[model samples]
Target: MIKRLSLISASVALGCIVTVAPVLTSIYIADEDAERREQEDLQQFAAKAVMRTELVTYQAFAAISDMEAPPGGLCSATQIAQFARVVFNYRYVRDAGAYGGGQYLCSPLSGDVRAQHLTMPPPDWRSKDGYLLWYRQKNPLSNERQDIQIGRNGNYVSIDPQSYVDLIDPARRPIAAINVETNTILALSPGADADDMLNAWKLAGQVNNEQWHYAVARSASRPLGVVVKSPRSSLVGHWPGLLVMWLSIGVVVGGVLGWIAFRRISRQLSFPATLEWAIARKKLDVVFQPIVRLTSGECVGVEALVRWNLNGRNISPEIFVAVAEQNGLIQQLTDLVLDKTLDELSKLLRSRPSFYVSINVSSEDLRTRRFLDVITARLQGTGIRPAQVRIEATERSFMDADATRQTIAAFRNAGHPVYIDDFGTGYSSLSYLQTFTIDVLKIDKSFIDTIAQDAASSVVAPHIIEMAHELGVEIVAEGVERDVQVEYLVQRDVQYGQGWLFAKPMGVNELVVWLSESSSTLQPIHQ
Candidate 1:
């Protein structure tokens, strides 16, 4: 009885720690959370600031770059209509005109410049590029607002000042600006204190003694920066609530675990039991991410992904799948997924006979004829063809050559094309390519991401492509998010593509709606 009591105490404590670790760690790092939140906020502000300021600068510079001295100079409307038309297309410019002698410039605003002239105050600052700029110059058309008027030599453009800081939260009073050539910090928003802004910029990612948070963010392309400061108390408002919530969770978890440990210690109430229970109760969910043909952009098929929830919280398939593999529960798990998959996709695959669904199986599943038998049994009544189901085994599955090769042959003989998933990431062998008769190779996302990059693996993709071409197997690029990657794959005449660029993983209902809604965009392709 004493030994049982000790076991209960240890088990409950272990369970409690495992569950409450993240929450407790969160409490410890809540201070850092304020810094992170502020950094993200300032980053957004900085990006907007730089984008707006650069766009306005671009408009002004573009007009300046394209502008030449009018044959009639400042008093005449020499192609003033052309200049006005260009400015109309862009939302930033308040005015455009020629500048000379610090006075009376012909502009879109100056209808008859020979008779009426808009005088200029001396510029607030001069840029290194021989351009003159005014800060918050009062609008002659409306005293209620101001604009930034900048010009050089024969032309100038005035930008609406409000557009620069429009996205900023007015309540936060954050300051944003662009650093132009010659290290000039051009302010975008009003009420900027140069010293305070600079101090916050240097003291980024730090909490002050008074519990105030200060942060600064800079753009990668330019010297544009945003500086913001907030009271730590504002962001940490839910601290007490979260503290109480986690504490209550700990108490409840510990009590439940104590009860479980006391009564269930003699039985198999561990992870395997929980998994077995979940399988029996049908607690696993399968989501499908579409795989499309590269050239035609047709939704050719989908890959089945398994998801599990334990005690109302999601457990990553990476962790739990490994658990299943280690505990020899993978076959049962695969069976459950296979049964669910055919039931869900039977209608879709049957309607689109050309389309196929790929299912990932473990190294263990590929060792013998049992897996093929299970699959054959599952597809018996679903109206789904064996050809409509593809088998995916990672490179690790091919390590056990005799059994895996036999299984792959059985699957292929049964009309299921075998694919080597995440091909380059596993197993140090070119032997698998010579040995396993895989119909397709799904290049891992890691290699796909390296396309056109300066990384060392950038060269590896071309070699992999060349090797695949030599072997006569089709290619499927995974995790393709960028147009550049699609272009790269398309240029190589790769067969298929999959990732967020096409579609995200979704449920059966969503997939049906998606396929129906997006059919117009997809072109029919033959396998």
Candidate 2:
């Protein structure tokens, strides 16, 4: 029996090291020196692509904007047509237009092109410059082929007038439309379904709007754009690392199972050095990430992120939390975190009463009656208003719909604010908002990361913000990194933002010093 117990202890110790130790190491001990290096590489690649496309589009528009007009009232229609060709031939704009009052002054890149059963263009057609200016010029009066081929082509394929370009009767209907208000040309996309393209155009700023995917940026005094698309093949490259990570996880699980089987068959003794070290020598620390109000750029709150400080290495939350919960020490850890957080906040709040503090709560805390009693007693004892405390519950915790609803109600009834943290992750059930008393929805960093790119978050993020607003819950964007992300979030009417952009996690003394030094001068990194 003694031998078997020893073996069991060994298995547990090994499991703890593999699972819990990693979490502790990541959160507390991992080398921040090389942190997010891969993510940074990906971000830089994305930023460069976006900037390049933006610059190209800008150049095309600027060329058109800078064209010399003929000495005439409005520059004759032919002159405008020549200018359109010149701009389109610059290998950036898919096509250019200077149409007014339903008359197409220039031939668009693709004339009356059609796709399989549909007359429209593909969403990603302009990635190649080959087809930018391939249309043939036609006499606006009689359907006669003109000498001009609209724009210069590197590989000149003589376009057929009778069968292709000039076949469409200009007098019959307007080919390409233009928005004089925005100076944007509108044409029937050849590769997309005509109905879908029309709907996309009509639904500007809405989901699947092609215009949202392509940006028109100003560069060198040109109001044009270049569309740079990363092939799906390249996006597929991210899968290898993810696959390796998952496979490593599977191997770890198999090792634990094999160890369990071996221990069941033949008992052996091994020292529980890892667990002993973890329980006895482990030090707990907290990192403070600033949460700022978007409009005023004022630091309103700080989230206390727990870190497992190992003697020589920092442990990750991923490993420690699992082990802590499995070993039923989560409550103890929570108690420690709560005390540490409140102790720090007590001083900060004494000075800034309006200042708030947010702390994460485990599902165990919600289910346990003693946890509530403990928190309530502390709140009463400390004289901290419930409104000043923000409880962040993960999406996974809220998956237990009944318990989450009950806990949320209990906290809100006691005047405490409950927020749905990591908003876009796990189960994003709209029913949670309807059933529970949620005060705010914190957008996950993944969504915030893509705000600069705009297309990915332009519709989805706004929908989330709008939905939260409709429910009277404030929206806070987390992990904001750049000025563009901030600008985009503010434009989307997000009320609060938090991330490295505002401030890194600081110790109590450092935080106080920072607040004193820059309380009035705190501004968004851009401003």
TM of each candidate vs. truth: 0.50, 0.50
Note the Cα lDDT for every prediction shown: 0.72, 0.54
Tens digits of per-residue lDDT, candidate 2, 1-527, equal 99999998788667645654434343332333233332233222322222332333334434544443433334345645555566455533334433333233333443321221221122122223333332334434335643112222211112222111111122221122212234333332223233442343344313343222321112221222111111111222344564455345654674675566557434311212343345444357776788888877878888888787665777788767766776677777776677777887787776677888887888887764566666788877676777777788877677677877887888878777888888755433343566677888998887677664624233345546766887888888998888788888777678899888778888878888777776768666333
* lDDT score of residue 349 within candidate 2: 76
lDDT for 255 (candidate 2): 61
Error of 1 at 373 (Å): 0.8
Candidate 2 global lDDT: 0.54
TM-score of 2: 0.50
Superposed Cα RMSD, model 1? 14.7
Question: What does the lDDT read for residue 191 in candidate 2?
Answer: 30
